[model samples]
Target chain A: MSEPTADLLVVEDDADVRASLERGLRLSGFAVRSAQDGPGALRAVHERVPDAVVLDLGLPGMDGVAVVSALRAMDHDVPVCVLSARDTVDDRVVGLEAGADDYVVKPFALAELVARLRALLRRGARAAPATTPELGEVLAVGPLRVDLARRTVHVGERAVDLTKREYELLVVLARNADVVLTRERLLELVWGYDFATDTNVVDVFVGYVRRKLEADGTPRLVHTVRGVGFVLREGG
Target chain B: MRRSPSDSTGAVPLSACSPARSMSLRLRVAVASALSATVVVVLAGVLASVLLAREQTERLDRSLVPGSPAVLGSFASTRADLAVTLRGPTGTVRRVSGPELPLSPVGIPTSVTVDGVDYRIRTAPGPTPGSLVTVGATEDDTRARVAERQRLVAGVGVAAVALAAGLGWLLAGRAVRPMRRLTEQAATLDDTTSAVRADGSRESEELADALSAMLARLHAEQERSTASLHAARDFAAAARHELRTPLTAMRTDLEVLRAHPDLPERDAVLDDVLRAQGRVEATLTALGQLAAGDLPDAGGGEPVGVADLLRLAAEDARRAHPELAVVVEEPGADVPESVRAALEGLRMALANAVVNAVRHGRAGSVVLGAHRGADGGVVLTVDDDGAGLPAGEREAVLGRFVRGSTAGGPGSGLGLALVAQQAARHGGGVRLEEAPGGGLRVSLALGPDRAG
Candidate 1:
């Protein structure tokens, strides 16, 4: 695949790390603009709309999560890939929840980060392509159903009051029913942020979904990959 | 302490502090043995005393009572005979051969009593009724003698019993003495350092077995934990190896771009790339060092001059944080020659300390001193003027990745922790103390240790 000519905005607090990432990304052929902090990143975004963002979670001024949230509030949909030195599983989950498209744990292999960036960009490109099934603003699947437009859900024939969070979580799952969605990807799509709050909100909410679904034997789903992460499967 | 046997033995309370099972078992055995023997001896002595008194009384009574009838039968004899004579309903005669007989009681009987020289007499039918004769004297004296013998026997028996109880106690204490010593030794032992095996006699064989079993379990746990630690280090090393290549390439590229000034985007791109590469490389470096230090200062460095180490360390700190006060306390600074290099390592560790003190610790008197401890090893103390690391995190800050909030710059945060590791490797340790003027004081102790 050819590198995109559109520029990529890289936001990080550490000058040395920000510089290295831009150099590598540019070498891979993506045009890169660098920002040392959140204000700089947001300013850069306004100055020129980039194809994607490479954001660091531990920014000095406005954190990466706040920056993503602000951009989302402004109705921007540029794909984001979070880069941070905190490699913990919860950290990855937190970053994704803040609207990041993908994340790389620090001390991460550069190759892995590059691969992650490519995957996220590929997803964005496919979503825009007319040939790919354009998932409607609302979709429902089996007994586990979602209304993306209303941002709500229903289990079987019962109207379950889903939280804004739960509704968004269900929409992501419904959009890719029967497809295994990594916990990071799920968090990114639902939470619209790129950092974890150290809360087991992911596992907790998954348990909630399972509990609600099993209230009347509505079939089981949401399988976990032990050491990896969570994946939502269909019945059985 | 009491001057008595009681006060002389503080070991009593110390023994009481021993494990409850063995102590209780010993006490139970003592009580049971004493009780069983006491009951047997007391019952047998009482029965024997009663039977012996009865036998002696019977001998005196039989002779005295029979003679009464004989004396009565002789009542018709001559007055000069001085013997009493009497005739019963049949042709019976009663006579007492002795002259000292007291007047008997009025009740019918074949009996006589003698008090000193006086005599008393009485007659009674024998098994054949009035056909019996009675004669007796000195019966009163005889009964008094019999009573005296009985008293003597009872007194002797009481004394014997007291002796037996004392003897039994002595035997029980003597038998349990070795066991008490075994218990005392067991309680004082620090199993964390060296192995301890139970050594007790056959009587205390059970106690020894229990101790040995527990020690064996302790040894097994220590071994398992050591093995697990090695496995973790290996795993970390492997991870570092796998993550190093791309990080190297990224770093190289950034360094390359920095050398070229013509490209407009080169500098910007190089800055971000280098930053990323640095994080990756720093992580790898930290990981590798942590794994390598998994086995701390195995025996390395001899007694290097403490003064030399301190001076070298001060120079380093001067370069790192020249603004901070780095003063050496030369009083009683006798650093052993064997720990010279170890002290140098200490200085490196302390340079980090000085920098941190300069950074986070208040800029106060940073005293670095070296001296010999009471245990015959050199001790070095580094005092910083910064607010002391919290007591809770004093030990924790020495762990990998954890650092004080005062870590403002992009530091590796491995400095203090590495110092701890180095000290540990050298069969020594580092401690967190409150400095004289209220700041963080880290004392490093190093002696001899084998390399891991």
Candidate 2:
């Protein structure tokens, strides 16, 4: 999938892990830059922003989450794929919530990480047309409204706040309104993952979306179809 | 310590033992009454006999008055039950018609023997000058009358004594009824008996109340110890269950490595092995912290500054995650002067919150702050810009081994649990809420000193 060498920055705390990732990614036909700590990673990015950044969540000083926040604060639109030794939902959500494009848990397959990085870079290059509807397009179901261009949602007169993943899930469900989309289908459609088996990430994000949407005691919109999946409709 | 013949058998022969001693309260009362009754009867009999003999002698003296009508009539009528006599003035002796009473001319009464019979006699000056008058009562009739009166008194006295003794025995038996019941109830004492209702006397009721109170105290002590024992057992069991997972993973990974030293994905395999080991280590540390949290405070704890603790936590978070922007907000007004808490424990709890914000929330900026909680405790909060946990899981995440569905990373799953444990130990609690910047804000409220 690489026609030209992709520029990448690798930030990690462990020396051996950093060395291995640098070597492996380099041999996999990519330009790799390495930093051992948070400050070093930030300096590397300030010097010259890479095409993509591979960040480790744990660092000696200034962890990966802070690094991502700094990059975003600096208006660096470069794609970020975080590497976390802590394989927990909170850690992944934190990275993504801080504007990281994706995350790879530690002890993960090198090939899988490479694949995710490639996918992130690819997404950064071209807009995700399937996930993002036509510009300025607004989809409405009952009191709920989604503005594709502004990336915002409203129910009645109130605007609902949603996390990035939650927004993605809502968009997917709204796009296929009144349809009972199974968990597998939602995972594939929203997360762009065909093999998210045994993961409740979809359900979790759906929960987030539902809570934000109905926070004001609004009528239920995201109705769950037990033993199946979920559906978005106005009423029963 | 030597065993004697009796000690060896642990029993005494019935024949060698004392008789079936009637030392009961009823027997004692009966014996006491009988002894008093005997003394009264003897005293009454002696008194009655003396009174009767004096009366007989007085009657005979009246008859010897010489001019007394009743005395003259008795002498003229020749009453067989009485006798009278007179004597000339000088050195005269008198013989009473009753059984020949022997009497000297003296103004006195006397008891004497006449004709082998008992007699009461009296002598005095007669109406004629220098004349002696004497009177006598027949010994048989007077003696018989005295004896009969004494016998009747004795019979009545004996009857009275028997009645008194019988009544005393019966009343004693009635009075000791409650005591007997109390002894019987005490003999049957067991764990299942809730209370002893002493139905007899006031003293017996007091004894029962005392025994019941003792039983209740013993029961409470037993219950308390049993509960603590169960708690310890549960702690061990929970620790075992929590440790099993990582240990199993490590074992499998180690077995794989041992089987294939030259595996193509040796680096990846090694990483897996290390990850498993890290999990085990993390779990062990968490277990230690949990045990620390479970310990009861020894009291006399020094007060801790709430604001200072928050600041320290922020600094620690910054040092650990240098890239993460951590700020200590201005301390809120009206906050407690100090919270009574274990310093190290409170510090660890605050640190856990910061780590949660930095590691789990992926917070861009963490702000540590303090305020006075509604419950009058010091509320220290760590606010992050990372994604907050779902509202439903806010409470669930505080329990041990309960990872939030939103959490991602290698976690011992005891981070928040330790925070909760510390809060509980300090007589406080932890609350989770949404932060200002769409992230989680974890608040640790430490109670103030109880003395306050």
Candidate 3:
């Protein structure tokens, strides 16, 4: 809170690669610092207290995943973004689950890494910072309702628990009730990718949101169109 | 469907002469034997007929011509339908016959009779013309005929010929048919599998069995060839891999040294190392390509331009061994790209031939020529007009690690083998023989897509 701008920690072993990254990121308008190995990277975290870290999976004295797990165990949700050269599905998954905010493969563009880091920073910075409405004041559905400011949901007199992606989808549908919302349009407005409607991500997530809302014979809100898309409707 | 190797158990080995055009063995033998036998039998019968007629005529002339028994002395009664005749002087013998004859000076005797019964007879003079004695008898009629026993003998001969022809056909079919197939299988004998067998096992049992056995043996040989080929490939790969490590280390060390600034005195060492590296790279690349089943000129394309490739290869030679001389001798329309690549590779191979010659002999000119071969194939001849390879080591040089007695320089010993390999890839090979003007001639002749 005392600093006007945030800091970024880069953990990699190869001196050539480390120098290349540090030079690139410094030019990219981020106050960047580097660690030669894994042990040095963890120690830098307490001293400098950076806004985010760009980490590598392969390390010398300490393992990269163990470092990430140790940081997360201390309840430090500082949004770490992993950068690795390993091109494998397992490597990405392990990085993400170890509390990395996002992961990028190496030989990646400098602009792309900077953009992803900015997105992580934006998440922490953009919190409305204004008069926010409470749940049930702005949203309700079929004896079920949500209060966004209060961070709670109500079904008649009861409440429910929903994950982040699920809550966002339901909120969009409840706000635009009784209207035909194509999966593409929903992905654009809610998930921020209209061009990626070809994926089944929309259907999977909608199903989860619908299940939570209709947990015990409550009224339904999500409707599916055969071979077309989905619509948010009430009572029909 | 993918038939199991075992499922090819009853494959018949077909041959080139397997009744494809000519008559079958059985038919040919049977027809010839039967016809020959018939001819002998018929000729014998005609000979017997002629001999019997001559002998009977001679015996009649001997008895009747000299016996002077007047044939007119026994003339008795005469009638239009009935005539009585008398024989002379033994006793008066009278005969009744069919008709009266007009009086004539001479008549050829047909049949004569005595007493009241007719007889088969013939007339003759009784030692003189005036006194005629008929010495003919009924025996002549029987002798003139084809006899029952002779007919029986002839019939038996004909029957024997028929039986012999039939037996010949069956036996020839049984014996020679399988042999034909066996020969065919042997000719086409790709010795690749275990069950090299002939078809129709039960019908052509003996032949099929023998053929199957032979094919099985040949197939065993084919398997041996395949195994040797695999072994060659593995050896090439292993040699390349093993040799490349040391070569790379050497090259890398040399490269590192050349990068340093203060090596003015070590220029000769650096140049030699670089040249050596180039040679090692070429060798390793060739060996690696060979091991990977991607031989030089492997793409079966059209005839390549011989002149262009030769020129290009000469450039390469000039760069590598500037001291050596390369000459191109050809005057024809440009060849195809495939031929060009092949000829290019061969040119490199031949350059080595000249390089070896130059390194050994005090001096020599390697002349390369291209022309249309007698077989309509593009012929390329590389000749080194120098101290040639010794007569005893002619074939030895084409084999691996076999350097000529004249060779002294340190080489990979794979140059000629590479040439041989490249020639083989083009469906041809290299021949080392006497040159036109007293030197070694290495003529690499390409065939019309046939493995010559």
DockQ of each: 0.21, 0.02, 0.01
Q: TM-score per candidate, in order?
A: 0.45, 0.48, 0.32
Which DockQ value does candidate 3 get?
0.01
lDDT of 1 at B160: 61
User: Any runs in candidate 1 off by more than 4 Å, and if so which?
Assistant: A1-3, A129-138, A141-145, A148-236, B1-410, B413-452
**Per-residue CA lDDT of candidate 2, range A1-236, in tens?**
43578999999755445656676677566799999789999899889889989888866458788998898888786778786655457767777667676666555566566666665566555545655667879989999999988888999999987655567678888888999999989856655555544445566566667877889999899999999999999988
Query: Which structure is stronger by TM-score: 1 or 2?
Result: 2
Q: Regarding DockQ, does 1 or 3 come out ahead?
A: 1
Q: Which of the predicted structures, 1 or 2, would earn the higher DockQ when compared with the native?
A: 1
Worst 10-residue lDDT window, candidate 1 chain A: A191-200
Candidate 1 vs candidate 2, lDDT winner: 2
Given candidate 1, what's the lDDT at residue B427?
Answer: 70
Q: How accurate is candidate 1 locally (lDDT)?
A: 0.61
Report every candidate's CA lDDT.
0.61, 0.73, 0.59
B196-292 per-residue lDDT for model 1 (tens digits): 3334457566676677677778888989998998977755544543343345446545544654556677655665556555656766665665556
Order of candidate numbers by TM-score, starting with the best: 2, 1, 3
In terms of lDDT, the poorest run of 10 residues in model 1 chain B is: B76-85
lDDT of 3 by residue, B1-452 (tens): 44444434534423222333477567998887788777887787667656656566456434323122233333322322223232434433333233332222233544444444443344543443244344333333445453644576678778878877887787777666655565556556443533334454344556657667776777777779999899887566445533432343344335335444465535654555555566567667656544443443456644566666567656765676677676776646543223534544566666666665565443356667765556656556767777777778788787754456576544555667666766676666777877775777777666645312
